[model samples]
Target: MKKTITATLILISSCLLAQPVPDSPAYEHELQIGLAGVSSQSIYLGGKSQNRIFPAIDYQYKRFYFQAGDIGFNLIDSKDWEIDFGMGVNLVGDTDRGDSRLLKDLPNLSLPVSGFISAQYKSKMGLFKVKHDYEINNKHNGNSSSISYAAPIFKGQWLIMPKISYEHHSQEVVNYFYGVNTVDATLSLPAYQTGAVNNIQLSVLGLREINEKWSFVGNIQNEFYGDEISNSPIVEDDQRLSVFAGFLYKFF
Candidate 1:
């Protein structure tokens, strides 16, 4: 997945040097570098949120688009509807801090990437989007789906979007991250398997344009875990919250 995504990125960058027809829309691009943090309330592995500064790329040329850490290409584009193919990264960071004994002895899981197909529609109410993804690394081999809404405000320069999404974890994924195998099961933590909806998240995204070349972005989200996830002996929290704020420089 990483290789395919990287190659696609290179191909998109090459488009920046291409010469479009006289009437083709001008190229649009943005680059951002800033700090981000996510504070998790999960009790599993005593995990804590992290803060890090990183660079982001937002590039759009005709039907192709890349934003933040995800990249997508439009398969269908029209006045009020669009279909896109996208890919994103999944992180299993900071699994060494929790107090759960069932989790303490477990090995840490590595990161995996996902690829998705999404469809979007715009109406008077707002813009609605839904997507389905699969883990491309075969590590977790998990599958997930999500639906979100976006409402642009202030002539579309500023925006507010509220979204809800649900994620299903494969038995393998749950076992690796939340399961207690027979060999490792103890009196307090028995062997268990999880293979259903494990996470549901609600979030709002806000963006404001400072000028033609500068803008600000912010988002806050709350995630609620399902019984399968919350019931794990390694887990401590039924819910968690995360936030991000950043700025960007746009070009044309």
Candidate 2:
């Protein structure tokens, strides 16, 4: 969500505009709001899939940028490359087993807000980016790094982008979400800790410019967990996927 936020912002600034804004700090970057529906795994321990509607936002001024729930500033910029420091929140939602015996006794975990540094490069073929985020004010003390590529296909008023990404989660992050601590472990669940480099993803995004005031968007994303995550006793599956579609009206 956060990466796409920035990608859309880049699309707006570079592709949508006929001229680039100079390095003037005084600019009115308008607020862009869009409605979207996102679906994905309910929990990292391999729970059922869940879907919800969320608002997407993206705006930029000078070197500072804000998108979705992330905020950041570019520290380096070339004609086609940039490095930025950004922050986003982690929503470690609650868990209820209900009738699912697979999640019988897994204690609920709290997700904390996180900060990350990201680098990006845009080429005629595609856009490449790398990001690493660390948890703040939480028991999860590790970080995750993601490397992704996005290819843009432009046809008249329609824009399509396909993306692939690989993510690596540190040991602390894996354990915090999927491990069975001694206190929470039962006879069937043994205390365990996971390893690193645990997630891979692929996605495609579509956008239709509805005149100059509105744009329609749709996205499909899939994820496959590595051994560290799939091998967990609490995990039931190794793959997760999501689809999102929405519309945005430009006010400025």
* CA error at residue 14 for candidate 2, angstroms: 19
TM-score of each: 0.76, 0.80
The global Cα lDDT (0 to 1) of model 2 is 0.63
Scored against the true structure, residue 108 in model 2 reaches a CA lDDT of 54
RMSD of each: 7.2, 6.2
- Which residue pairs clash in candidate 1? 45-98, 46-97, 46-98
Question: Which whole-number lDDT from 0 to 100 does residue 151 have in model 1?
Answer: 57
Number of the top TM-score candidate: 2
Instruction: Return the lDDT, model 2, position 152.
Output: 81
Model 1: residue 194 alpha-carbon error in angstroms: 2.1
Task: Give the alpha carbon lDDT tens digit for every residue of 94-134 in model 1.
Answer: 23423344466665555567787988787777667787778
- Candidate 2 lDDT, tens digit per residue, 1-252? 343333223212211221112222335575556776655554344355555555666677777877655678879988787798877654222233112456666765444567889888878877888888898877677787888888888788777777788878888777776677888777777777767755778877777878777778777767787888778777667766567677777676
- Predicted structure 2, TM vs. truth: 0.80
